[model samples]
Target: MRHLFTIALVSLLLAPPAQAQNDVRFQVLGGDEALRDALIAASRLQAVTDEEDSASQDIVAAARSDYARLLAVLYEQGYFGPDISITLNGREVAGMSPFDRITQVRSAAITVEPGRAFRLGRAVIAPLAPGTDLPEGFRSGAPAGTVILRETTEAGIMGWRTQGHATADVGNQQITARHNEAELDAEITLAPGPVYRFGTLIPRGEERMRTRRVLRIAGLPTGEVYDPDEVDRAADRLRDTGVFTSVGFTEIPNPDGTLDVQAELVEAPLRRVGFGAEIQSQDGLTVSGYWLHRNLFGGAERLRFDAEISDIGAQNSGIDGFVSGLFSRPADLTPDTTLELGFRIEHLDEPTFVEDTASINIGLEHQFSDELTATAGVFARYSDVSDNFSERSVWMVGLPLGLTWDSRDNAFDAASGWYADATLTPFTAFEDGGGVRATADLRAYYGFGEEDSTRLAGRLQLGTVDGGDIAALPPDWLFYSGGSGTVRGQDHQSLGAMQNGVQTGGRSFAGASFEIRQDLFGNFGAVAFYDVGYVSEGAYGEGASDWHSGAGLGLRYDTPIGPIRLDIATPVSGDGTGEDVHLYLGIGQNF
Candidate 1:
């Protein structure tokens, strides 16, 4: 009971402020959900908005300030005609005793009478640009509010500007309220100047990265009709490159009825190095590091090298080491395309296999839009492997195609977003036999409440190998489960197709995970999660297969980089069982 009470208290405190500890009891009487919530949110009823001492005079002063603030809030909610009263200890604040004499404090009451919400009687905006789509509520008999009026005005002006009018303004405005009829009438007009064409790209104040590279990256549609959105997109492109500390675009009128765009850039550091690590109770430890040269080849080219070592524990000496180097040149093809070349080497020692491999891959990735990207590559690899029973050597080449769609607000810690990716690789064996493999993954996040204090996240993954013989396929082409990204409570890569009691890779795989996250305190959070994984020797679940499930709890400490995560879990059901629980420590959300 005590623990339950403590948890309850903490939860209440974490919620966006109604907390007064039974002191200064606050209430709003007689109002709809929207009106009551808005009034409380913008008034002293909220802990953040309460800025006065507990004394009666200070409290009364704060209460008085709420009158205007909440009035404006209601006006935006279409409650143009309102009667609001504030009282302290059941006595009207207007009739309270002098602050010098009144010392006692008790309860506060806010009552709102939003009599007969107002609606638009007539909404007239003249000279609207073609293709203007304003707020849906900007019409006769619709809800009348300040927000609608402001949005309608901005939309009209933006619509004109989008049609090549570089200069657009609100030329006139008239607003009136009919108190007897509970109605409002709004009249506005927009003034749009003549259209203008885009002139040449003018580079300004760019160093280190070169002006031509900046122009190529910006990809502004020069010699086309002037559009503000194009300038914004150009700025976005420059910022996304990470080579610039700051980026901006400015417009200037030319004598030839054209608008010239000037690109401004501030250079960023060219070199950066970073390191991170993760530890798991059952899986041992993993450490990784990377170094990047942002503009090594001068045309926004990037050269990167990274390495990692995993599994440093007593029960096993089969540690794993991996290293890779990659070089990418942006805008080498089209404006939204990048060319990449990479090489990698892996050294592995596991219960089932001890192997080493070296590989190289070359790819071209194109950005179709902000949310979509596609890439195709060719890869070659050679490997030597020795299992507990025998040894084998093989080499292969393959063509890989991949597509991704990302709408997440934050890649590492998302609150309301979705991401999906798919990859297909087809290889022809030089020594053994080859096949085609395909995999796909999807993840989504959703949040609730005003502050998004509660979040739900989910993920699904699937994999298959269609052509290669089971023994001839590259070990890396197969799939396994029971890791941080799969069934967390189980040992890493512990669940797979079994051969003579040895866990080997599988040709088909599926995994699902779900989590519910709750905020506990500032920058602190907790989660309840469930994960399940399935792997089989058959491509379509035809051969031997197994299923595993795990449930867990996690703690998160938010940071600028991402979230520091600590998870503890146990297997609910699985094919392999060796440990009662597993603990994982890492950075970033598990997807």
Candidate 2:
């Protein structure tokens, strides 16, 4: 449509001038406010309005182009009949002969008198399949817009395609404009080919991956009715497996009412290595690295190894180290399920205690659907932990079960949707006793206004360990709130159970946070948030009810990976010395 207007403008712009002139201006005269504004917006004259030394021919060309664009826009807006005139300086475009020459030009004018808008006089679409989704404006007596008419045609074809018809399209279309009655008559015919079922899938670009596995991963249900959504999903599954850098699927025409599927794949690099580092006010320097093998054991299985070391600042000496190895087998028992195996080792020396642990777990994660997943596993751990008051070594075995429901549109900047997760782990201390640990977390997000620029996000977490001795358990198993992950105004794990003037992880924990986010200009945005947390040595009860709160403001810069956050908060109320403010830096939202 725009190209058509440009062509018209080129023909209208015929300037016989000797010298070039600048200082172009634009004006919209005589039309309805909305229509006149639309024409002005459609005009291209304003693009070169600041060209002070433009040639006379340039100004004339600009005006002519503006007139052409304005006319198209007027018609598309349902105004088939409109009076349009383009004037350069004081000379009318029609009055200037082909031989007339100009030396200088200053002003340009576009006058549009858009008449009454045309309505849909007689709208008819033949062979429109039942349940076809269409625009409301495509009906008779509604405003006749060119865009709407095109959308109506597309909707009709899509309707047939949804009902197993793979080759459905608009066979013919006729749109007649009537200037006498200010109306438009539209007629469309559609052709839907025979219903198609799924056929055999042929694979290509399979260098490292086996063709049979590729077909299995695609998981296309053969003999089922054809659906474009299904084809797209199969391709998406191939892409999400991490084994493929690129994936494509094409439909081949076949006989017997079936569409043959052709799969094209690009295998990702077999091995990858990367590293990262971060610095914080309280935690010093943290460095980390990882290695990955996408097709470790074939069948799109992944193997990974990672290591991290932290607390390396000049002033701080409480350093920590961690290492882990992970493996996952895709499509283990079901297409959307995976078998995962993991082993981890960590050494921690904090203000509260010194702790070391080695843990291993084997789990099966089944994706029930796009929004939900369930994981069940058995884990074993051996840990030696000591604090100022006590020290202990323990061996523990546990059964872990977890479920998560996530509907957030974007992980970094979620404007709408809710997420919830729950985990229950029952453990037996080999030489001491037995206990049960349970936790549930809920997060919700909602946006207001256009494009969801303003959003409200919130989270609530609850946890408890019922029978284990708090001093004997692994430090990581216990909960402590106060950090970028929880209340930001306080130091890391600074608001936990107090023992002999030192902070210690608690068996019972609760934390909640709320944020109001508003995007500013470009990639910048601002947020106001409040967070509260409670931790105690005993399970959640009256005696364990010491809650600390923090309220503050934050700034965020959006990135493809996530949002970079800088939250500066002050303790609203809690175990703090006077008014201590803290600044926390990280990626992604606080949650």
Winning candidate number (TM-score) = 1
* Regions more than 4 Å wrong, model 2: 1-77, 82-114, 124-133, 136-138, 271-273, 313-317, 449-451, 498-503, 536-543
Off by over 4 Å in 1: 1-74, 79-116, 314-317, 498-503, 576-579
Worst 10 residues of 1 by lDDT: 15-24
Give each model's clash number. 0, 5
Clashing pairs in 1: none
Model 2 per-residue lDDT tens digits across residues 395-462: 99999999999999987789999899999999998866889999999999999987899999999999
What does candidate 1's lDDT look like per residue over 1-591, in tens digits? 999989977854553422232344445455578677777678764442354344444555776777898889888978877887877667777665553233444667777777777899989997988788989999999988899999999999999999998878899899988999989999998889878888877877766777789889888888899899888877877787788888877888787879888877778899999999999987788999999998886678899999999887713337899999999988868778889999999998765577899999999999888899999999999888776435778788999999999999889888889999999998888756677889999999998976889999999999998886566565667788887888888777777786445567888999999999989999999999999999998886668898999888999999999999999999889744545788999999886
- The C-alpha local distance difference test score for the whole of candidate 1 amounts to 0.82
Local distance difference test values of all predictions, in order: 0.82, 0.80
